[model samples]
Target chain A: MKNKKPELVTTAATLEEVERVFEAGADAVTLGHERYALRQPGHFELEQIKEAQQIARKHGGRVYAVMNALMHHDEVGELAGYLEQLAPHVDAVVFGDPSVLMTARQVAPELPLHWNTETTSTNYRTVNFWAGKGASRAILARELSLEAVLEVKRNTRIEIQVQVHGMTCIFHSKRELVSNYVRHQGKDPEQEIRAAQRRMFLKEDNREDQRYPIFEDRHGTHIMSAEDICMLEHLSSFITGGIDALKIEGILKPLEYIQTVVSIYRKAIDRLAENPHADIDSGWLDELKSIQDPARPLGTGFYFKQQIY
Target chain B: MLTQTVQSTIASPTKRKKPELLAPAGNLEKLKFAVLYGADAVYIGGQKFGLRSKAGNFTYEDMKEGVAFAHAHGAKVFVAANIIAHNEDFEGMEEYFRTLYDIGIDAVIIADPAIVEVCKQAAPHLEIHLSTQASTTNWQAVSFWANEGISRVVLAREVSMEEIRQIKKYTDVEIEAFIHGAMCISYSGRCVLSNHMTNRDANRGGCAQSCRWKYDLFEEAEEEDTETPQIGKTELPMFSEEDDSFTMSSKDLCMIEHIPEMIEAGVDSLKIEGRMKTVHYVATVVNTYRKVIDAYCEDPEGFVFKPEWMDEILKAANRPVTTAFYYGSPTEQDQIFGVPPKMAKYDFAGLVLDYDEKTGIATIEQRNHFAVGSEVEFFGPKRDNFIQKVEELWDEEGNSLTEANRAMQKVKMRVTQPVKPYDIMRKEKK
Candidate 1:
């Protein structure tokens, strides 16, 4: 039997964006409430979530609820009810903290779980461990090299997801390090400081060539990569490797940019699905560059280079 | 096997077990010192499959010796194999787990679920304690791991006292928490700054501590400049100039004043971090907490916090201390900017090797410089610290010496008070 094509997944902030990305050839869109999700383009309320699911169904696409927060005790009491309300509306729930699993089992036993512990989802045994706990899929950490990713795929029977494009978060602190720094400067932080607009960057003391984008929200401060990950040229390894999904991180990207990127990946996956050994499409790279932020260059992140000290 | 019967208000109405004092041992010597200093259990890393690769990690022989020593002293030894493993990294882990089990270690602290599975299958008797690197924060996560047969879960440093109390109320699994040590600015195992900037994987024992590195913050100009800004050469105003640079390093966690609160929270283990710290640090921190925990468990109703314990820890602290996330969220005060060298209030003078009570001559091994007339403090695990002035010194060959300056040099001194082996002598900074 021919291998099934991996689902092309991306994030959406609005119902219109959900409709647009699905129209642009994405197979699924992920969104959730501000309280339950970590970094997302925007949070959707319960009503909006149902509407997005409806839109996905109309377009033959899927909806994934981002229940990926490392939950606190105060947040635990609200999870059961949230998952109960969220059960019938989405296809799967992507989570990092296992508390979601415990709560979901009690309130929504039928809801599927996709484990994404951010950076700790490195090896295949752990992937299978989550699969034993009934996770339908596992999102691999972006820090894995291509060789390691293929190895994990070869070893695990569960469906797997990999980020093929866009900004990758390098650091996340539950404390408001940025706001605390603002207060330490003796100035009240302007409301814009907390916004995820790509306006704030960190430069190392002596090394001046790199800029790391940083911002603060309810999940606390997040520092993103100086270069966005663009895996358009390497779509064949994942396609032939029998991976289940290819995710384009659309957390801070504009809707138009996300649509274009999703279209590029969608076409690439289709081409590779038809012909596993295919030449690079020069036009696709050029199209991504035209829409990507000039300040943030695109690189094949951790796919080739070993990130070691 | 090392258990203590103390008190816990949240776990049960009966007299609950007191929390175990867990200390870090980078090597065999540190392990012995930690056990002698009253650690109920000590965690160490082997030369493989662990973080803190820079430290003097134990070999299999060292682990066997260390485990024997700890068990003989009524303490337990735990090996940390907490690296977030990749595929190739799993090569020898099963055999490593079997070897650790054969050595009769109390448990293995692991973060990777795959490795936990390997340990369960290869060495079925070995207990598994989840590493803080897993960042387990809430009770449900604890329950999830418990269902997976994890005996203990180390609560993330981000967890609050109230959260811990609630977690204990709901879950019967043992909970471990960090009470003293440096803290990661990000959620443990949730950061890759080192990998991005320096090509070092922080989750896999190659942490360069990139978070402590200083950075310059800038506000990007609004409105797309037709000119794509050059990476760092732009004319953005540097907001961190006044302090030289911006740093996100957090203050060290210290709970010397909150012993009763921690005990009442039903924490099974109170762990001290810093596997890369010095022997002096292990001794000082372990000795201080040992005294406090003993005092509180002995007289729960009348226990009073001691200022001396805080003073003792300050001698070895590198940065200021904060009760991180215990009371609530940490603020500006909890962060450290413009890195300062490790605080040096006292210098380790020597270690007592042997003492002749009749002759009043103490044999010592010099760690740092100390003169004949230098005043020093002698302290032991079971004895009160006493101050004495060095009147004279002699080399091992019986040659009279004015000072012991050579590192690890054997010196004989006329000590007024009787001192035992493993006793520490430190001098105030001149």
Candidate 2:
């Protein structure tokens, strides 16, 4: 518990967006590809990250490095060393790989790191399990509504970070389509044709369809792209609730998605500056639905134990 | 017994008792057509829980009435309520189970283990067929479910036939193999790509099928720049780094020639996977296999498969047919999932218009070409009664017609004798 502070952390892959999130009132910025990978190798080298850290520090915002993707052990060790060199400038590192966390602890024992949600840190047992692994905080599953989140936080010592607003991932874990993309491309004539049989998918400028679906058979590709996740209406209640970190997810969403989402969420958060009320003003819900969400359906999330309807 | 039905009918010719020709019936008309064409037992989904969401899934009212209708004709109906459920979704199941129980539907095919537990609690008398979504790939998995009181288990298509024999040995569970239909790229229908890429979960029946979509990636080229630089003697790409990688997709599943081998594996039931498909696909594919399975059953020793039947199987709107993982072991070469042939020889337009009892007249509405010389198969009532011969054809005006070619072509037909309503009329494609 970094002094038991309520840190409004917004995750982003780009520095410019991180700056925008801070301007919108983020307490800290967690960097990694939140479904958006960094295009340049290692995404950005240590020097580039150091520059981003300086920008974040200027606004009194902390920088948290995120290594969410599946990484090789050696590469993780190398990054751990690089991260150690950047330790004096950065805050905690959000991590999942056992090796990466071990190396981070070995290299810079003082740096704080939260266990990434890839570890499926849901129950108190799991949260405490990761805590034993040296994780100070745990990101709760997006599908667990408000009440569920509070239950876990109450039971576990690790602080809770809930996805406040962003794209909801139904493909939570397991890498089938991506693996197919990486493995089956180029050579086989059969695979080339099947890819053509698939439907089209566009997420933040990334589009591909293997005519044949990567998962379920011939009924085309079974997929659902719902709207973005927006919790504006439920914010006051969530803040009053046990959530420690309010997260806005979109490293790959457009600049407009990043900016508008940050601004709206910022206003909603500020609305609760005095007493946190549970009432969700209808206008906030409307504004959220009006936004262009390329992801699947948006949910108020299973956060509130109280299903208002 | 039923001699006039066997040799003169069916695909190849079976040496032993013919495997039941299980066919799909999405609607009442298709159900009638299926039974008349010698379907041993028919499988369908009532509106609630079946694999094919787009199917004319059965409603409660439809199931109650449909079950009675199927039973009147001396056939069986297995209702599908295979939707996967989470804890919160288990509220109204008591009534759902009782409703299915009262309807007299032969059995309910279930997917989720939770739902199976629910069914056991709610409807103790009801029989259960475990849906393919259970992904029973091993003998242990099959026997485990069987111990839980599953009457039949639809084996995952990925399992090899060798495993089937092994599974059969360990458990008394009736194994149902998908004799034909679409292929799943993910292992055992549990891909989150649907829920992840889209909020649709394939396991829960609301799969938006995200795997079928095409995505482009930059493939790391073979000739890495000598500068494919080792930053710290590591080969992995750095995070946040962009690389141009390419992607590919998987193909559909089809197995027509390997029926003999699959039958040899001791499957109690053979399943065909096209609930969302049209009636024409059902009739054509069912009739083709019906003939082949019968041939194999008739002459266990003296049977040679006719090559023309393979050509007949391809006439369906199919992707490239692979034997699937049915042989001793599936080789990499056995995996054939490419683009489907752009053209189909048959469109399976519509059902036979009607049938005359005395004159044995069956009317046909053509979805494809039916020539005087071209053989049209009459899949008649009960197993082993489907007939293949184009001795004659009559037009709508009752004039004996030679050829009827167009979309929705109707013709009056005079069969040898005794044709009943609900008999399917399909012409062999090749």
Candidate 3:
């Protein structure tokens, strides 16, 4: 299957757990800070990242170090310089921004660069263009349907990874999910208020999210970017189509989340391997419906004919 | 007059000045290149405090030296502390801002109110360039940022020149627009493709760039491998379709041909998008735009950009240049689905291997796998292009042959006239 897991990422799977998940049919683990901005002075502490890399060694899972929401240009090189310490230990460092890609290329020529979807790579030229800049892979936009993905694949030799399951960017990766958190608490608001204030942009809570301010497109700003993409039905295409990986988004969930998602894809992967193209059992889809992917809003995502099921 | 200058309405900025070509310098070399090439100001980042954290972002020493170099070259430097700052991120770049401001960095692009308030207190004298991440598609948003003492606004790339004219009419803040390069797929630069797959928000400039990934399509409406009939249809079925517009992708932006409209609309500074591009990329693009702009300035009405300029521009390096959003709403015609990457064509013609004025033939290293009878387009400086078919191809030893595939091998070819040291040769794609 083309589904190798587009550079697997997860907070749920540890080095060993991740190895088993991949062995059990997981593809890659995108390492992100579950604590989020709560980590330290930076998006992540270098030592913590180093430890994650060390742990990732056991699984042989390609470690895609997630450092996507940084605003400072300085951090590009700093994080890249930091990644240089990891060397090939970290399989790829996913990042957005043309400028950041340039820095990563100069710093770690051998280490693969995966273009972050935040960089908004939506077409064949972008794929080939970034591929020319040393990008080996991309996290396809969730908004893209299966046909679009195939079109993107045809444009370049770069590997295509799809999100089969996970928490999607609520504002399509733009607005800070926690902006309200910043505004009300900018200098001061109570702890609960502070918690309530977290916004996707402001790092504060977004009151706009509740009332859902109108989006610029004259649409609603009810943040919608990252959504869960579970193709339990099309697991066979995930393999035979040459997808390097099938990613599961949320690592913040309980280990049960990990166990359930990894185990399901594993079974599906096996089934597909045995019978190159087959339908998934209805019961399995029902069981998945019971899981904690409510945040994903239940869509098969873009890789399908993309019906609004 | 001196006293009124400080108090004048037109001069609200305590540090008032006309905005210049604010270019994104992705690396040390590009920093110098941009400054020398014609940029009045350059924006950069060290290890942490800028939006394009992924551009060949400068190192501490690289940034420091770049600042110094630009200052030395009569240019200004702006540090991007533009990312939306969190409580933790505040501490990460707090000291850097103070130090940079104290050391004479021209400005700092900012968005988050928290960051702005912090900078106001921390680096009071530091000028602020509001980033495009703020999504200032309207004058209200511009007015909002302007209220915060923002001196310049990098208006969202999606806004049209007419809208920009309206914004310039309303706001006193200097406006900057991205005149060239790759554009983001989301509205106003707010994307979360990264955080969805990896907890990275694109707006804070930490985008995982999910828009670029290749995907495989299975028609979800059906169970089998059969082609879903409506798969390639571009028209939305309106009321019959789902609630969402079902957009497939975002378009690339380029306003090069529309320089006059942008200038007339009141953009103070023109911006180019590649921060991670190579020097070759910067030089070719910057030089091309520079020529185009000069051409327009020379004759606004009578002058027209020749198709040859656009063709030569294609050779410089590009993603099929399109007039994204500027002309009207972008559609599939602008989209490049399966086009083979256009490259520096005409292969390596004879280098300055030997320029013998006595004989018009310039000995060149044969570039492509060429046979004796292939027609190739030759390119040189100053509107130089011609269809020159290779009537004959002979080896270095003077043996006439059908083709030459050997590496570093030399071949003799005749030209209409003698070629110069910096002249280049290429072939057009059929």
Candidate 4:
């Protein structure tokens, strides 16, 4: 039997980044227009998404539009309309909300759907549920270990996507905690509640030195992992585990970071394609270490040891 | 606004069947109290494969009795088989579902599609209600479940009144919403913080409630030490001041005032959410909602929300109340940040174990401190509450006592009125 290597999935915030990522050899690039996604500092407009789609297609890459925000009832009507507009421009719409997934299935029946239940799809049964409901791909939760991922792969035949790089979100909430904090301090929330701009971190009193970045946007607050996930070393394991796609999580990251990270994964995947049975090159690890953000630490995340609370 | 206008124009309670009042029961005793206190349906967790593992969940034998008790009272009993089952968790689930069905459980509240499939194979006759843990927010999601033969969807807490109206308009699936309960900081109940922090899976039955823990702020050090290039840089303290505030603990939701809005929106059921709560909590909250719902149904046009209902609700609340995301997204005011110690004015006094009509005395299992002269109100199934002074008290040993303080202590107290088993006694607010 021929060994099938997983595709490299990367995220981009703009058409420029999309071009850079495609140049770096990403098979598919995930992007979404502003106000329609959970990402902060999201700048892509409908025109930008269309442009990015055109660039990806030109480079023989695919564009997956993110519709992963937790929707309120009022947004449903607008969302159906937005999905209808964005459908033709993208290959598949990635979603965390069931409502959004079902809405996409209704509004754009031809468009494929990627189910990312935002860490809630902890087991294979949830993936199977979405698969039965018409999800073409299922993004495994960040909390899943490699063993769990293997278990899921063995059970379900649906294409599986795993976050192999960048920040892992630990906490997500609808309440704007940072805005509430500013208001509690007697400051105007409008002026002082620019949490995404500030790039603030939160630490528990007990675990004083550890801090996780708190990202706030129109959708809600997202507290990301203290350390960025680097699974460059585990590329072979994921491929062997039958993962369909290895996703790089940071879309709004610096273009240099995106290019470097995507290129590293691209090289890794290419090397694996050449020699499927060969061990991951130590030089790749060294190269990843050289470009590691001094401010942000790197860890293997829950892929090695599952986070339990 | 349209719902408000329509509700206001209804000169009398609409002839439509009033939505069922659903209550949570942690144990068999609480289940009886929930049905007795005017709950049309009661949801409980079994010994396994359910959320609220800390709750004194029913054994199979207890469930059999509880189900019979509920059915006898014309109320439905739902077994919460709502855990997000992994492959290992499904080992004994099929047998569990068969047992639940054989015992005549009205429905199985489930979240995982695999478990729903298991139930279908094991107990095809049983109805299925999707748990809020499934996070059904939109009509399409509800439609998806409805197509799968799910009779009801406990809408996610993130859903709003406007959305409920829209969902009802679009889908035939019955909507059951949390009308009163502790709120989760995460969307729906799909949180992993508890599991990540404490190793207790929140999706499975164990939740350590890590969100309620206090957190301090810290910033990552921007500059690296050039002299010690190999050494890791330490994170810097973001704030010099110390503050003890719970940034994640949300206020308990209270929707007593919004009963009209819910009814007008065509919600199918109003669910009260504390399964691990005491029987007194169940009785007080269930009774208060029962009165409010009845009042609204009696005269929709003449239905004026009484301020006294809020006062009645406070007697059962442990935390400050917020309307949650019902009106809109909750503001800073909606959350309780600082840990303000709260005490309900009325304390759960005791539960009547038995009453001797000849002696005019009741055998009570004391829950809180109560003295001989303390004025207590006794309430029970289909009976109006009556106040009486505890003139005499006797321990199980027949020794006279002036007061009862120890929890679960059996004490005989003189009563002026007849009290039945399961009747709850409470000390009045001074």
Q: Per-residue lDDT for B363-418 in model 1, tens only?
A: 99999999988999888897778899999899988999999999999999998789
Task: State residue A88's C-alpha deviation in candidate 2, in Å.
Answer: 39
Once superposed on the true structure, which residue ranges of model 2 sit more than 4 Å away at CA? A1-309, B1-21, B72-74, B196-201, B219-250, B327-339, B349-362, B365-423, B426-430
- The models' CA-based lDDT, in order, is 0.88, 0.60, 0.57, 0.80
Please state the CAPRI-style docking class of candidate 2. incorrect
- Give the candidates in order of DockQ, highest first: 1, 4, 2, 3
Expressed as tens digits, the lDDT of each residue in A189-227 for candidate 3 is 233223332122111121111111111111212333323
Best by DockQ: 1
**In terms of lDDT, which candidate is stronger, 2 or 4?**
4
How displaced is residue B248 in candidate 3, in Å? 4.9
**What DockQ would candidate 2 receive versus the native complex?**
0.06
Best by lDDT: 1
Tens-digit per-residue lDDT, B1-430, candidate 2: 5886665556544346555566777876567656655577787876554566766777777776667777886778887777654334556776888888888877778876557767888999899988776556656556656767888888876567777887787778888888787766544444545544444445556666554553432212123444422111211221123433222233445567777777787888888877677776666677677777877776767767878667666666556565555753333333332343454555453355677786677787776777776655554333333445666777777788787777777877666645555555665456
Task: Return whichever of 2 and 3 wins on TM-score.
Answer: 2
For candidate 2, write residues A227-298 as lDDT tens digits.
456677767656666567888776335556666677777666666645465355567667656664322356
lDDT of 1: 0.88
Evaluate candidate 1 and give its CAPRI docking class based on DockQ.
medium
Clashing pairs in 1: A308-B199, A308-B200, A309-B200, B6-B18
Give the local distance difference test score of model 3.
Answer: 0.57
**lDDT tens digits, residues A135-231, model 4?**
8889888777788888988889799999989887777787887777657656676764443343567776676545567757777777777677898
lDDT of 3 by residue, B1-430 (tens): 8778556644433222333566778888788767765577888776775677677877667767898899998989877766644223556556777877766788887765556666777788898888877656666556656766788888766666667777787668889888877777555555554544444555556676554442211111212433432122221111122221122233355666777787678788888877887654564456566666666655566668777666556665556667765655454444443333465543443333565787677666655465567665554434345667777766778788787677557877766666664344454444
Write model 1 residue lDDT over A73-178, tens digit each, in one string: 8898999988998999999999889889878878988999999987889989899999888898999999999888888889988889999998889999999887
Query: Candidate 2: global Cα-lDDT?
Result: 0.60
lDDT per residue for candidate 4 within B74-94, as digits (tens), equals 999998988776546778888
